[model samples]
Target: MIPWVQLDSAKTPDGGQELRLKQRGAEFSIMLGTNELMNSRLSGSEEALAKLSCERIVGRSQPKILIGGLGMGFTLRAALAELGADAGITVAELVPAVVAWARGPMAALFDGCLDDPRVSVREADVGHIIRSDKAAWDAVLFDVDNGPEGIVYKGNDALYSAAGLGAARAALKPGGVLAVWSQGPDSGFARRLKQAGFVVDEVKTRANGKRGARHVIWIATLA
Candidate 1:
């Protein structure tokens, strides 16, 4: 049996928690305390977050996408695969080390997706990006945190708040979709999405192919 090796660690923006990256043989995982935020081998829901959102914006000319988190490049790679050359994606990763891990130890897992012409990576808060522009994205996918209320970072709660959802609405073009990945269902978040003028659809998915963790993806559309 192979033992897990800690490759590196980074402190959360609030400095209240730490994110640790570990590798076991060919597999990799990002952890917050005892909770594993993401694992290279379990990316089904993350890929679905991209695939589902891309499907909603098909055939749009020069579609723009904003991905909140760049965990192992799962969502970004999946979006790149589903979207056409006319589509562009901007990924905002809060922790700089997460981006570094994607280009460093987990580089092979990303498979050069970061270098794709349609993709742009930034080390910044997705929340801030949402508030920075108006009607800027065709699809905004959040592959960040545990859920609306994240355990890794205390500030993530604001991203799911009423005002935050409103900011997301203002940032999205009409009929654009906002796809969010969660470990499980949070009925309260769904209610908030509805209250924010979005037509929300909650979909269930697995962390891995037909197995692993049972996850949830909320595809909210701004009508």
Candidate 2:
């Protein structure tokens, strides 16, 4: 068995926690304390986040997508696979080091998706981008933090709060979709999505291509 090697570390924007990147041979993981935020070997749910959302807006001409996190670029790659050449995707990743890792040790895992002509990477909070735009995106996909209940950063709570959901709503075009990935189900979060004027559908998916632990994905669409 190959022992995990700590390749690098970065301080969260809030300075509340340190994110460590560990690699065991070809497998990679991004961890916060004892919690593993993401693993390269397990990307089924993350890929689904993009596939499911793109399914909803595939009919649109040149659809614009905003991805909250760029972990390993699984979601971005999946989105690129599902959408047409006219589609554009903007990814907002709060931690600059995560982006650096994708270009550094994890570059092979990304497979040059970051260099795609249709993709743009932003080193900023996804929440701020949501609030900054109004009805600008056709789909907003969030794979940030753990879920509505965040563990990596204290400030991430707002992205799942009522105000945050409202901002997300305002940032999407009519009939757009907001897809979220979670480790587990949160009925309260689903209800909050409804209260914020979205039709929510909860889907269950595995972390590792139908083998690992079941994860939750909320597909919320604006009527």
Per-prediction TM-score, please?
0.98, 0.98
- Compare the candidates by lDDT and give the number of the best one: 2
N/CA/C clash count, model 2: 0
Query: Compared with the true structure, what per-residue lDDT tens digits does model 2 show for residues 1-223?
Result: 8899999999988897899999998899999999898899899999999999999997899999999999889999999999999999999999999999999999999999999999999999999999999999999999987889778877889999999999999999999999999999999999999999999999999998969999999999998
State residue 50's C-alpha deviation in candidate 2, in Å.
Answer: 0.6
Residue-level lDDT for 76 in candidate 2? 96
Segments of candidate 1 deviating more than 4 angstroms = none
- What tens-digit string does per-residue lDDT give for candidate 1 at 154-187? 7888899999999999999989999999999999
**Which run of 10 residues does model 2 get worst, by summed lDDT?**
145-154
- For each of the candidates, the C-alpha root-mean-square deviation to the true structure, in angstroms, is 0.7, 0.7
lDDT of each: 0.92, 0.94
